[model samples]
Target: MGSNPTLSVFLNHMFQENSYEKIIQTAILTAYPRIFTDIPLSKEIFDELERIRKTESHGEITAELKVSKLAPELEARYKLVDQLLHKNNATQILEIAAGLSPRGVEWTKNPAIEYVEVELSEMARDKNKIFKALIETPPNLQLKEGNALNLKDLQKSITHFKKDRPIAVVNEGLLRYLNFDEKAIVAENVRALLKIFGGVWITPDITLQKLLQVQNKTTMPGKNQEIIQRTGRNIEKNSFKNEEEAEKFFNNLGFTVERHSLLEVIDKLTSSKKLNISQKEVKKMLEPAVVFVMKLEDSRA
Candidate 1:
Protein backbone atom coordinates (compact mmCIF):
# COMPACT_ATOMS: atom_id res chain seq x y z
CA MET A 1 0.00 0.00 0.00
CA GLY A 2 2.05 2.89 -1.31
CA SER A 3 0.73 6.21 -0.02
CA ASN A 4 -0.17 9.06 -2.35
CA PRO A 5 2.03 11.82 -0.92
CA THR A 6 -0.77 14.36 -1.07
CA LEU A 7 -3.05 12.25 1.09
CA SER A 8 -0.59 10.30 3.23
CA VAL A 9 -0.74 12.54 6.28
CA PHE A 10 -4.51 12.50 6.54
CA LEU A 11 -4.72 8.86 5.55
CA ASN A 12 -2.26 8.07 8.30
CA HIS A 13 -4.42 9.97 10.74
CA MET A 14 -7.52 8.13 9.51
CA PHE A 15 -5.79 4.78 9.95
CA GLN A 16 -4.81 5.74 13.48
CA GLU A 17 -8.37 6.77 14.18
CA ASN A 18 -9.61 3.43 12.80
CA SER A 19 -11.81 5.36 10.39
CA TYR A 20 -11.24 2.66 7.80
CA GLU A 21 -13.00 0.33 10.24
CA LYS A 22 -16.07 2.49 9.82
CA ILE A 23 -15.82 1.88 6.09
CA ILE A 24 -15.70 -1.85 6.78
CA GLN A 25 -18.98 -1.52 8.68
CA THR A 26 -20.47 0.24 5.67
CA ALA A 27 -19.42 -2.61 3.40
CA ILE A 28 -20.85 -5.14 5.84
CA LEU A 29 -24.17 -3.32 6.12
CA THR A 30 -24.24 -2.63 2.40
CA ALA A 31 -23.77 -6.31 1.69
CA TYR A 32 -26.50 -7.27 4.14
CA PRO A 33 -28.91 -4.72 2.69
CA ARG A 34 -31.72 -5.47 5.13
CA ILE A 35 -29.47 -4.49 8.03
CA PHE A 36 -29.39 -0.81 7.13
CA THR A 37 -30.70 -0.11 3.64
CA ASP A 38 -32.77 -1.80 0.95
CA ILE A 39 -29.97 -1.34 -1.56
CA PRO A 40 -28.93 -4.65 -3.10
CA LEU A 41 -25.86 -6.03 -1.32
CA SER A 42 -23.88 -8.92 -2.77
CA LYS A 43 -23.20 -11.94 -0.55
CA GLU A 44 -19.68 -12.43 -1.95
CA ILE A 45 -18.77 -8.96 -0.75
CA PHE A 46 -20.43 -9.56 2.58
CA ASP A 47 -18.29 -12.64 3.14
CA GLU A 48 -15.19 -10.59 2.48
CA LEU A 49 -16.41 -7.87 4.85
CA GLU A 50 -16.97 -10.40 7.62
CA ARG A 51 -13.51 -11.81 7.11
CA ILE A 52 -11.96 -8.37 7.53
CA ARG A 53 -14.08 -7.42 10.52
CA LYS A 54 -12.87 -10.45 12.46
CA THR A 55 -9.28 -9.26 12.25
CA GLU A 56 -9.79 -5.88 13.89
CA SER A 57 -11.32 -4.54 17.08
CA HIS A 58 -12.65 -1.14 16.05
CA GLY A 59 -13.13 0.26 19.53
CA GLU A 60 -16.37 -1.28 20.85
CA ILE A 61 -19.85 -2.33 19.80
CA THR A 62 -20.72 1.32 20.36
CA ALA A 63 -18.51 2.23 17.37
CA GLU A 64 -20.62 0.09 15.08
CA LEU A 65 -23.73 1.64 16.60
CA LYS A 66 -22.39 5.04 15.62
CA VAL A 67 -21.84 3.78 12.09
CA SER A 68 -25.40 2.46 12.06
CA LYS A 69 -26.65 5.87 13.07
CA LEU A 70 -24.74 7.48 10.19
CA ALA A 71 -25.27 4.75 7.61
CA PRO A 72 -28.66 5.98 6.42
CA GLU A 73 -27.33 9.36 5.33
CA LEU A 74 -24.43 7.82 3.43
CA GLU A 75 -26.63 5.25 1.76
CA ALA A 76 -29.22 7.94 1.02
CA ARG A 77 -26.56 10.04 -0.68
CA TYR A 78 -25.66 7.14 -2.97
CA LYS A 79 -29.33 6.66 -3.84
CA LEU A 80 -29.70 10.35 -4.62
CA VAL A 81 -26.67 10.24 -6.92
CA ASP A 82 -28.09 7.21 -8.72
CA GLN A 83 -31.39 9.06 -9.20
CA LEU A 84 -29.59 12.09 -10.61
CA LEU A 85 -27.60 9.91 -13.02
CA HIS A 86 -30.78 8.25 -14.27
CA LYS A 87 -32.48 11.62 -14.69
CA ASN A 88 -29.53 13.03 -16.64
CA ASN A 89 -29.05 9.88 -18.72
CA ALA A 90 -25.53 9.56 -17.39
CA THR A 91 -23.77 6.22 -17.81
CA GLN A 92 -20.50 6.57 -15.95
CA ILE A 93 -19.77 7.05 -12.22
CA LEU A 94 -16.46 8.24 -10.81
CA GLU A 95 -16.00 7.95 -7.07
CA ILE A 96 -13.12 9.98 -5.69
CA ALA A 97 -11.39 9.08 -2.41
CA ALA A 98 -13.63 6.06 -2.46
CA GLY A 99 -11.97 4.51 0.67
CA LEU A 100 -13.29 1.01 1.23
CA SER A 101 -16.73 1.95 -0.09
CA PRO A 102 -18.64 -0.79 -1.88
CA ARG A 103 -20.21 1.65 -4.37
CA GLY A 104 -18.23 0.30 -7.30
CA VAL A 105 -19.54 -3.18 -6.60
CA GLU A 106 -23.08 -2.00 -5.89
CA TRP A 107 -23.47 0.40 -8.86
CA THR A 108 -21.78 -1.90 -11.35
CA LYS A 109 -24.58 -4.39 -10.78
CA ASN A 110 -26.38 -2.22 -13.32
CA PRO A 111 -24.53 -3.20 -16.49
CA ALA A 112 -25.21 0.17 -18.07
CA ILE A 113 -23.30 2.09 -15.41
CA GLU A 114 -19.50 2.29 -15.87
CA TYR A 115 -18.05 2.76 -12.37
CA VAL A 116 -14.53 4.03 -11.72
CA GLU A 117 -13.32 4.08 -8.12
CA VAL A 118 -10.22 6.15 -7.34
CA GLU A 119 -8.19 5.59 -4.19
CA LEU A 120 -4.66 6.18 -3.01
CA SER A 121 -2.36 3.37 -4.18
CA GLU A 122 -2.17 1.44 -0.89
CA MET A 123 -5.89 1.29 -0.31
CA ALA A 124 -6.46 0.60 -3.98
CA ARG A 125 -4.09 -2.36 -3.82
CA ASP A 126 -5.54 -3.66 -0.57
CA LYS A 127 -9.11 -3.37 -1.84
CA ASN A 128 -8.12 -5.02 -5.11
CA LYS A 129 -6.81 -7.97 -3.17
CA ILE A 130 -10.16 -8.32 -1.40
CA PHE A 131 -12.04 -8.01 -4.70
CA LYS A 132 -9.88 -10.71 -6.21
CA ALA A 133 -10.31 -13.07 -3.26
CA LEU A 134 -14.05 -12.52 -2.88
CA ILE A 135 -15.86 -11.73 -6.10
CA GLU A 136 -15.31 -11.97 -9.81
CA THR A 137 -14.64 -8.59 -11.37
CA PRO A 138 -17.64 -7.03 -13.04
CA PRO A 139 -17.01 -5.55 -16.48
CA ASN A 140 -18.27 -2.08 -15.58
CA LEU A 141 -16.50 -1.65 -12.26
CA GLN A 142 -12.92 -0.41 -12.45
CA LEU A 143 -10.62 0.46 -9.57
CA LYS A 144 -7.71 2.81 -10.15
CA GLU A 145 -5.05 4.41 -7.97
CA GLY A 146 -4.67 8.19 -8.11
CA ASN A 147 -4.66 11.43 -6.19
CA ALA A 148 -7.72 13.69 -6.29
CA LEU A 149 -5.56 16.78 -6.58
CA ASN A 150 -3.95 15.59 -9.80
CA LEU A 151 -6.09 16.04 -12.92
CA LYS A 152 -3.73 14.18 -15.21
CA ASP A 153 -3.81 11.18 -12.91
CA LEU A 154 -7.59 11.39 -12.70
CA GLN A 155 -7.99 11.55 -16.49
CA LYS A 156 -5.65 8.62 -17.05
CA SER A 157 -7.59 6.40 -14.66
CA ILE A 158 -11.03 6.91 -16.25
CA THR A 159 -9.90 7.09 -19.87
CA HIS A 160 -11.99 4.06 -20.84
CA PHE A 161 -15.17 6.12 -20.54
CA LYS A 162 -16.19 8.25 -23.53
CA LYS A 163 -15.78 11.94 -22.82
CA ASP A 164 -19.04 12.76 -24.61
CA ARG A 165 -21.06 10.54 -22.27
CA PRO A 166 -22.11 12.24 -19.06
CA ILE A 167 -20.19 11.17 -15.92
CA ALA A 168 -21.32 11.80 -12.38
CA VAL A 169 -18.44 12.18 -9.89
CA VAL A 170 -19.14 11.21 -6.29
CA ASN A 171 -16.80 12.49 -3.57
CA GLU A 172 -16.96 11.17 0.00
CA GLY A 173 -14.52 11.47 2.88
CA LEU A 174 -12.13 13.67 0.89
CA LEU A 175 -12.95 17.28 1.64
CA ARG A 176 -12.97 17.02 5.43
CA TYR A 177 -9.21 16.40 5.42
CA LEU A 178 -8.08 18.91 2.82
CA ASN A 179 -6.86 22.45 3.42
CA PHE A 180 -8.07 25.29 1.18
CA ASP A 181 -5.26 25.01 -1.39
CA GLU A 182 -5.65 21.25 -1.72
CA LYS A 183 -9.38 21.80 -2.04
CA ALA A 184 -8.80 24.25 -4.90
CA ILE A 185 -6.78 21.62 -6.71
CA VAL A 186 -9.58 19.12 -6.20
CA ALA A 187 -12.19 21.63 -7.46
CA GLU A 188 -9.99 22.40 -10.44
CA ASN A 189 -9.74 18.70 -11.25
CA VAL A 190 -13.51 18.27 -10.98
CA ARG A 191 -14.01 21.35 -13.14
CA ALA A 192 -11.72 19.80 -15.71
CA LEU A 193 -13.57 16.48 -15.56
CA LEU A 194 -16.93 18.21 -15.99
CA LYS A 195 -15.56 20.31 -18.84
CA ILE A 196 -14.74 17.11 -20.67
CA PHE A 197 -17.49 14.75 -19.48
CA GLY A 198 -20.47 17.11 -19.05
CA GLY A 199 -21.97 16.06 -15.68
CA VAL A 200 -22.22 16.95 -12.03
CA TRP A 201 -20.05 16.59 -8.88
CA ILE A 202 -22.01 15.32 -5.90
CA THR A 203 -20.68 15.57 -2.33
CA PRO A 204 -21.64 15.96 1.34
CA ASP A 205 -18.83 18.44 1.94
CA ILE A 206 -20.24 21.93 2.24
CA THR A 207 -20.98 21.97 5.98
CA LEU A 208 -21.09 25.01 8.28
CA GLN A 209 -19.57 25.10 11.78
CA LYS A 210 -22.60 26.76 13.34
CA LEU A 211 -24.86 24.00 12.15
CA LEU A 212 -22.44 21.35 13.42
CA GLN A 213 -22.39 23.02 16.84
CA VAL A 214 -26.17 23.08 16.90
CA GLN A 215 -26.35 19.49 15.70
CA ASN A 216 -23.93 18.34 18.39
CA LYS A 217 -25.94 20.10 21.03
CA THR A 218 -29.26 18.67 19.87
CA THR A 219 -28.28 15.03 19.48
CA MET A 220 -24.81 13.41 19.52
CA PRO A 221 -23.41 15.71 22.15
CA GLY A 222 -19.56 15.87 22.34
CA LYS A 223 -19.10 13.20 19.67
CA ASN A 224 -18.19 15.59 16.87
CA GLN A 225 -16.01 17.58 19.25
CA GLU A 226 -14.25 14.41 20.35
CA ILE A 227 -13.40 13.56 16.75
CA ILE A 228 -11.91 17.00 16.15
CA GLN A 229 -9.96 17.01 19.36
CA ARG A 230 -8.74 13.44 18.99
CA THR A 231 -7.62 13.87 15.41
CA GLY A 232 -6.33 17.41 15.93
CA ARG A 233 -8.22 18.25 12.81
CA ASN A 234 -10.28 21.40 12.63
CA ILE A 235 -13.24 20.58 10.38
CA GLU A 236 -14.48 24.15 10.51
CA LYS A 237 -11.36 25.40 8.76
CA ASN A 238 -12.03 23.02 5.88
CA SER A 239 -15.69 23.91 5.30
CA PHE A 240 -17.53 27.00 4.09
CA LYS A 241 -18.47 29.55 6.74
CA ASN A 242 -22.16 29.13 5.89
CA GLU A 243 -24.43 27.79 3.16
CA GLU A 244 -24.47 31.19 1.42
CA GLU A 245 -20.68 31.29 1.40
CA ALA A 246 -20.60 27.74 0.07
CA GLU A 247 -22.89 28.74 -2.81
CA LYS A 248 -20.87 31.85 -3.69
CA PHE A 249 -17.57 29.94 -3.54
CA PHE A 250 -18.69 27.21 -5.91
CA ASN A 251 -20.34 29.74 -8.22
CA ASN A 252 -17.04 31.55 -8.54
CA LEU A 253 -15.51 28.25 -9.61
CA GLY A 254 -18.11 28.02 -12.43
CA PHE A 255 -20.57 25.54 -10.92
CA THR A 256 -24.28 26.07 -10.43
CA VAL A 257 -25.20 24.21 -7.25
CA GLU A 258 -28.20 22.65 -5.51
CA ARG A 259 -28.21 21.71 -1.82
CA HIS A 260 -30.19 18.95 -0.09
CA SER A 261 -30.24 18.22 3.60
CA LEU A 262 -29.52 14.68 4.78
CA LEU A 263 -32.57 15.13 6.98
CA GLU A 264 -34.79 15.43 3.93
CA VAL A 265 -34.13 11.81 3.00
CA ILE A 266 -34.49 10.42 6.53
CA ASP A 267 -37.79 8.81 5.61
CA LYS A 268 -35.99 6.32 3.39
CA LEU A 269 -33.97 5.01 6.34
CA THR A 270 -35.22 1.83 7.98
CA SER A 271 -32.95 0.11 10.49
CA SER A 272 -33.70 -2.92 12.66
CA LYS A 273 -31.25 -1.99 15.39
CA LYS A 274 -32.28 0.79 17.72
CA LEU A 275 -30.11 3.88 17.53
CA ASN A 276 -28.62 5.60 20.59
CA ILE A 277 -30.90 8.53 19.97
CA SER A 278 -34.43 8.53 18.62
CA GLN A 279 -34.94 9.13 14.92
CA LYS A 280 -36.26 12.61 15.65
CA GLU A 281 -33.16 13.54 17.61
CA VAL A 282 -30.93 12.04 14.92
CA LYS A 283 -32.71 14.21 12.36
CA LYS A 284 -32.06 17.28 14.45
CA MET A 285 -28.36 16.41 14.71
CA LEU A 286 -28.00 15.84 10.99
CA GLU A 287 -29.20 19.34 10.15
CA PRO A 288 -25.63 20.37 9.39
CA ALA A 289 -24.91 17.52 7.01
CA VAL A 290 -25.93 18.32 3.43
CA VAL A 291 -25.48 17.03 -0.07
CA PHE A 292 -24.39 19.37 -2.84
CA VAL A 293 -24.88 18.71 -6.52
CA MET A 294 -22.85 21.01 -8.74
CA LYS A 295 -22.69 21.22 -12.50
CA LEU A 296 -21.07 23.64 -14.88
CA GLU A 297 -23.42 26.59 -15.31
CA ASP A 298 -22.95 26.44 -19.08
CA SER A 299 -23.80 22.76 -19.22
CA ARG A 300 -27.07 23.31 -17.38
CA ALA A 301 -27.98 26.41 -19.37
Candidate 2:
Protein backbone atom coordinates (compact mmCIF):
# COMPACT_ATOMS: atom_id res chain seq x y z
CA MET A 1 0.00 0.00 0.00
CA GLY A 2 1.03 3.57 -0.64
CA SER A 3 1.84 6.13 2.07
CA ASN A 4 -1.13 8.04 3.49
CA PRO A 5 -0.39 11.66 2.70
CA THR A 6 -3.15 13.01 4.94
CA LEU A 7 -1.93 11.08 8.00
CA SER A 8 1.66 11.94 7.13
CA VAL A 9 0.80 15.64 7.00
CA PHE A 10 -1.03 15.44 10.29
CA LEU A 11 1.82 13.64 12.06
CA ASN A 12 4.37 16.04 10.55
CA HIS A 13 2.49 19.02 11.92
CA MET A 14 1.98 17.30 15.27
CA PHE A 15 5.68 16.46 15.49
CA GLN A 16 7.02 19.71 13.96
CA GLU A 17 7.79 18.27 10.53
CA ASN A 18 10.99 16.20 10.17
CA SER A 19 11.55 16.14 13.94
CA TYR A 20 9.94 12.80 14.72
CA GLU A 21 10.98 11.64 18.23
CA LYS A 22 11.90 8.14 17.04
CA ILE A 23 14.67 9.54 14.83
CA ILE A 24 16.16 11.21 17.89
CA GLN A 25 15.86 7.93 19.80
CA THR A 26 17.62 6.11 16.95
CA ALA A 27 20.34 8.77 17.07
CA ILE A 28 20.83 8.28 20.82
CA LEU A 29 21.14 4.52 20.51
CA THR A 30 23.49 4.97 17.56
CA ALA A 31 25.70 7.39 19.50
CA TYR A 32 26.37 4.80 22.19
CA PRO A 33 27.48 1.73 20.24
CA ARG A 34 28.79 -0.30 23.19
CA ILE A 35 25.52 0.10 25.03
CA PHE A 36 23.12 -0.78 22.14
CA THR A 37 25.42 -3.34 20.52
CA ASP A 38 23.46 -5.81 18.37
CA ILE A 39 21.65 -3.50 15.98
CA PRO A 40 24.18 -2.96 13.18
CA LEU A 41 21.56 -1.10 11.09
CA SER A 42 21.03 1.72 13.61
CA LYS A 43 24.09 3.70 12.54
CA GLU A 44 23.23 3.39 8.88
CA ILE A 45 19.65 4.48 9.53
CA PHE A 46 20.87 7.42 11.65
CA ASP A 47 23.18 8.55 8.87
CA GLU A 48 20.33 8.31 6.39
CA LEU A 49 18.15 10.33 8.78
CA GLU A 50 20.77 13.09 9.02
CA ARG A 51 21.01 13.30 5.24
CA ILE A 52 17.22 13.63 5.03
CA ARG A 53 16.85 16.18 7.81
CA LYS A 54 18.91 18.34 10.14
CA THR A 55 19.04 16.98 13.69
CA GLU A 56 20.86 17.90 16.92
CA SER A 57 23.29 15.44 18.46
CA HIS A 58 21.94 13.06 21.09
CA GLY A 59 24.43 14.34 23.70
CA GLU A 60 23.28 17.94 23.30
CA ILE A 61 19.64 16.85 23.44
CA THR A 62 20.16 14.72 26.59
CA ALA A 63 22.26 17.45 28.23
CA GLU A 64 19.52 19.99 27.55
CA LEU A 65 16.95 17.67 29.16
CA LYS A 66 19.29 16.93 32.15
CA VAL A 67 18.65 13.25 31.48
CA SER A 68 22.08 12.02 30.51
CA LYS A 69 21.09 8.62 31.84
CA LEU A 70 18.27 8.35 29.28
CA ALA A 71 20.39 6.02 27.15
CA PRO A 72 20.76 3.48 29.96
CA GLU A 73 17.05 3.74 30.75
CA LEU A 74 16.20 3.11 27.08
CA GLU A 75 18.59 0.16 26.96
CA ALA A 76 17.06 -1.32 30.09
CA ARG A 77 13.54 -0.95 28.68
CA TYR A 78 14.53 -2.66 25.42
CA LYS A 79 16.27 -5.56 27.16
CA LEU A 80 13.48 -6.08 29.71
CA VAL A 81 10.90 -6.39 26.90
CA ASP A 82 13.07 -9.03 25.22
CA GLN A 83 13.46 -10.85 28.53
CA LEU A 84 9.70 -10.88 29.10
CA LEU A 85 9.04 -12.10 25.55
CA HIS A 86 11.40 -15.00 26.18
CA LYS A 87 9.85 -15.64 29.60
CA ASN A 88 6.42 -15.88 28.00
CA ASN A 89 7.85 -18.25 25.36
CA ALA A 90 6.18 -16.16 22.64
CA THR A 91 7.19 -17.41 19.18
CA GLN A 92 4.83 -15.19 17.20
CA ILE A 93 5.31 -11.44 17.82
CA LEU A 94 3.57 -8.33 16.49
CA GLU A 95 5.22 -5.00 17.35
CA ILE A 96 3.00 -1.95 16.84
CA ALA A 97 4.40 1.43 15.86
CA ALA A 98 7.67 -0.38 15.37
CA GLY A 99 9.50 2.87 14.43
CA LEU A 100 13.24 2.42 14.03
CA SER A 101 13.44 -0.45 16.47
CA PRO A 102 15.91 -3.27 15.76
CA ARG A 103 13.94 -5.97 17.58
CA GLY A 104 12.26 -7.51 14.52
CA VAL A 105 15.60 -7.73 12.75
CA GLU A 106 17.33 -9.41 15.70
CA TRP A 107 14.44 -11.69 16.68
CA THR A 108 13.93 -13.00 13.14
CA LYS A 109 17.52 -14.31 13.21
CA ASN A 110 16.02 -17.40 14.83
CA PRO A 111 14.01 -18.86 11.97
CA ALA A 112 11.51 -20.38 14.34
CA ILE A 113 10.23 -16.94 15.31
CA GLU A 114 7.76 -14.99 13.15
CA TYR A 115 7.95 -11.23 13.65
CA VAL A 116 5.74 -8.52 12.12
CA GLU A 117 6.47 -4.82 12.64
CA VAL A 118 3.59 -2.41 12.03
CA GLU A 119 4.25 1.26 11.32
CA LEU A 120 2.85 4.23 9.44
CA SER A 121 3.33 3.91 5.71
CA GLU A 122 6.26 6.29 5.25
CA MET A 123 8.31 4.79 8.04
CA ALA A 124 7.37 1.32 6.90
CA ARG A 125 8.76 2.09 3.46
CA ASP A 126 11.93 3.65 4.87
CA LYS A 127 12.54 0.75 7.23
CA ASN A 128 11.92 -1.78 4.45
CA LYS A 129 14.61 -0.18 2.30
CA ILE A 130 17.08 -0.03 5.20
CA PHE A 131 16.49 -3.67 6.15
CA LYS A 132 16.93 -4.86 2.58
CA ALA A 133 20.17 -2.88 2.22
CA LEU A 134 21.73 -4.00 5.52
CA ILE A 135 20.92 -7.70 5.08
CA GLU A 136 18.76 -10.06 3.12
CA THR A 137 15.18 -9.41 4.24
CA PRO A 138 14.24 -12.42 6.33
CA PRO A 139 11.06 -14.15 5.19
CA ASN A 140 9.83 -14.28 8.76
CA LEU A 141 10.19 -10.53 9.34
CA GLN A 142 7.28 -8.72 7.66
CA LEU A 143 6.95 -4.93 7.88
CA LYS A 144 3.38 -3.78 7.39
CA GLU A 145 2.12 -0.21 7.09
CA GLY A 146 -0.74 0.30 9.51
CA ASN A 147 -2.12 2.35 12.40
CA ALA A 148 -2.68 0.86 15.85
CA LEU A 149 -6.12 2.44 16.15
CA ASN A 150 -7.31 0.63 13.03
CA LEU A 151 -8.19 -3.02 13.63
CA LYS A 152 -8.38 -3.78 9.90
CA ASP A 153 -4.77 -2.73 9.46
CA LEU A 154 -3.72 -4.78 12.47
CA GLN A 155 -5.67 -7.80 11.24
CA LYS A 156 -3.89 -7.64 7.89
CA SER A 157 -0.51 -7.86 9.60
CA ILE A 158 -1.52 -10.99 11.55
CA THR A 159 -2.84 -12.98 8.58
CA HIS A 160 0.53 -14.73 8.36
CA PHE A 161 0.39 -15.97 11.93
CA LYS A 162 -0.58 -19.54 12.78
CA LYS A 163 -3.87 -19.31 14.72
CA ASP A 164 -2.95 -22.48 16.66
CA ARG A 165 -0.16 -20.64 18.56
CA PRO A 166 -0.57 -17.75 20.98
CA ILE A 167 0.86 -14.43 19.74
CA ALA A 168 2.68 -11.65 21.59
CA VAL A 169 1.59 -8.09 20.75
CA VAL A 170 4.18 -5.53 21.87
CA ASN A 171 4.82 -1.79 21.66
CA GLU A 172 7.49 0.30 23.37
CA GLY A 173 6.79 4.02 22.88
CA LEU A 174 3.32 4.28 21.32
CA LEU A 175 0.76 5.16 23.99
CA ARG A 176 2.29 8.40 25.24
CA TYR A 177 1.26 10.10 22.03
CA LEU A 178 -2.38 9.02 22.27
CA ASN A 179 -5.12 10.60 24.31
CA PHE A 180 -7.45 8.50 26.49
CA ASP A 181 -10.03 7.84 23.77
CA GLU A 182 -7.44 6.83 21.21
CA LYS A 183 -5.75 4.59 23.77
CA ALA A 184 -9.05 2.83 24.44
CA ILE A 185 -9.48 2.08 20.75
CA VAL A 186 -6.01 0.52 20.67
CA ALA A 187 -6.81 -1.56 23.76
CA GLU A 188 -10.05 -2.79 22.23
CA ASN A 189 -8.30 -3.66 18.99
CA VAL A 190 -5.63 -5.63 20.82
CA ARG A 191 -8.27 -7.35 22.92
CA ALA A 192 -10.07 -8.44 19.78
CA LEU A 193 -6.81 -9.85 18.38
CA LEU A 194 -6.01 -11.67 21.63
CA LYS A 195 -9.50 -13.22 21.65
CA ILE A 196 -8.76 -14.64 18.25
CA PHE A 197 -5.09 -15.62 18.75
CA GLY A 198 -4.84 -16.31 22.48
CA GLY A 199 -1.79 -14.17 23.41
CA VAL A 200 -0.67 -11.31 25.65
CA TRP A 201 -0.17 -7.61 24.90
CA ILE A 202 3.07 -6.19 26.31
CA THR A 203 3.73 -2.46 26.53
CA PRO A 204 5.79 -0.02 28.63
CA ASP A 205 3.92 3.07 27.51
CA ILE A 206 1.42 3.19 30.39
CA THR A 207 3.10 6.24 31.98
CA LEU A 208 1.53 7.88 35.05
CA GLN A 209 0.81 11.58 35.48
CA LYS A 210 2.05 11.47 39.07
CA LEU A 211 5.36 9.96 38.00
CA LEU A 212 5.79 12.75 35.46
CA GLN A 213 5.08 15.31 38.15
CA VAL A 214 7.70 13.72 40.42
CA GLN A 215 10.25 13.53 37.60
CA ASN A 216 9.58 17.16 36.74
CA LYS A 217 10.55 18.05 40.32
CA THR A 218 13.67 15.89 40.40
CA THR A 219 15.26 13.73 37.67
CA MET A 220 13.93 15.37 34.47
CA PRO A 221 12.61 18.79 35.45
CA GLY A 222 12.18 20.40 32.02
CA LYS A 223 12.04 17.23 29.95
CA ASN A 224 8.26 17.06 29.66
CA GLN A 225 8.00 20.70 28.72
CA GLU A 226 10.68 20.24 26.10
CA ILE A 227 8.86 17.24 24.69
CA ILE A 228 5.56 19.13 24.51
CA GLN A 229 7.18 22.08 22.76
CA ARG A 230 8.83 19.76 20.23
CA THR A 231 6.21 17.08 19.59
CA GLY A 232 3.00 18.94 20.45
CA ARG A 233 1.98 16.00 22.63
CA ASN A 234 1.32 16.69 26.31
CA ILE A 235 2.41 13.38 27.83
CA GLU A 236 1.30 14.37 31.33
CA LYS A 237 -2.17 15.13 30.02
CA ASN A 238 -2.26 11.76 28.26
CA SER A 239 -0.92 9.71 31.23
CA PHE A 240 -3.10 7.96 33.76
CA LYS A 241 -3.39 9.90 37.03
CA ASN A 242 -1.62 7.10 38.96
CA GLU A 243 -0.96 3.38 39.02
CA GLU A 244 -4.42 2.65 40.41
CA GLU A 245 -6.02 4.61 37.59
CA ALA A 246 -3.82 2.88 35.05
CA GLU A 247 -4.70 -0.58 36.34
CA LYS A 248 -8.41 0.24 36.42
CA PHE A 249 -8.28 1.61 32.89
CA PHE A 250 -6.89 -1.70 31.62
CA ASN A 251 -9.06 -3.84 33.84
CA ASN A 252 -12.17 -2.10 32.54
CA LEU A 253 -11.01 -3.07 29.06
CA GLY A 254 -10.90 -6.75 30.17
CA PHE A 255 -7.14 -7.05 30.50
CA THR A 256 -5.27 -8.63 33.41
CA VAL A 257 -2.16 -6.58 34.07
CA GLU A 258 1.30 -7.70 35.25
CA ARG A 259 3.73 -4.91 36.09
CA HIS A 260 7.46 -5.45 35.62
CA SER A 261 9.85 -2.78 36.88
CA LEU A 262 12.40 -1.56 34.34
CA LEU A 263 15.00 -1.87 37.08
CA GLU A 264 14.60 -5.65 37.02
CA VAL A 265 16.95 -5.66 33.99
CA ILE A 266 19.35 -2.96 35.24
CA ASP A 267 22.14 -5.46 35.79
CA LYS A 268 21.96 -6.34 32.12
CA LEU A 269 22.63 -2.78 30.94
CA THR A 270 26.17 -2.47 29.53
CA SER A 271 25.77 1.30 29.02
CA SER A 272 25.95 2.00 32.77
CA LYS A 273 29.68 1.27 32.98
CA LYS A 274 30.60 2.68 29.57
CA LEU A 275 28.76 5.93 30.23
CA ASN A 276 30.07 6.18 33.82
CA ILE A 277 26.54 6.27 35.17
CA SER A 278 26.34 5.35 38.86
CA GLN A 279 23.88 2.79 40.22
CA LYS A 280 22.02 5.49 42.14
CA GLU A 281 21.56 7.52 38.97
CA VAL A 282 20.40 4.49 36.96
CA LYS A 283 17.88 3.62 39.64
CA LYS A 284 16.48 7.14 39.62
CA MET A 285 16.27 7.14 35.84
CA LEU A 286 14.41 3.81 35.76
CA GLU A 287 12.21 4.17 38.82
CA PRO A 288 9.23 5.57 36.92
CA ALA A 289 9.31 3.10 34.05
CA VAL A 290 7.34 -0.16 34.09
CA VAL A 291 6.67 -2.81 31.45
CA PHE A 292 3.13 -4.18 31.73
CA VAL A 293 2.46 -7.68 30.43
CA MET A 294 -1.30 -7.89 30.00
CA LYS A 295 -3.52 -10.81 29.07
CA LEU A 296 -7.27 -11.02 28.53
CA GLU A 297 -8.90 -11.31 31.94
CA ASP A 298 -10.80 -14.41 30.82
CA SER A 299 -7.58 -16.06 29.59
CA ARG A 300 -6.39 -16.32 33.20
CA ALA A 301 -9.25 -18.66 34.09
TM-score of every candidate:
0.77, 0.82
The candidate scoring highest on TM-score is 2
TM-score of 2: 0.82
- On the 0 to 100 scale, the lDDT of residue 49 in model 1 is 47
- Tens digit of per-residue lDDT, candidate 2, span 1-301: 1112244444544566543333334333323342333334655664554444343242233335234445676677788999999999999999998777788888999999999998877678767766665678789999998878778999999898999999999988778876676677788889999999998999988787755765687555777787767566777788887777888888988999999998998888777786787888878778878889999999997
**Angstrom error at residue 165, model 1:** 1.0
RMSD of each: 5.8, 6.1
Question: Whole-model lDDT, candidate 2?
Answer: 0.75
Model 2 stretches with alpha carbons more than 4 Å out: 1-41, 51-68, 214-221
Worst 10 residues of 1 by lDDT: 21-30
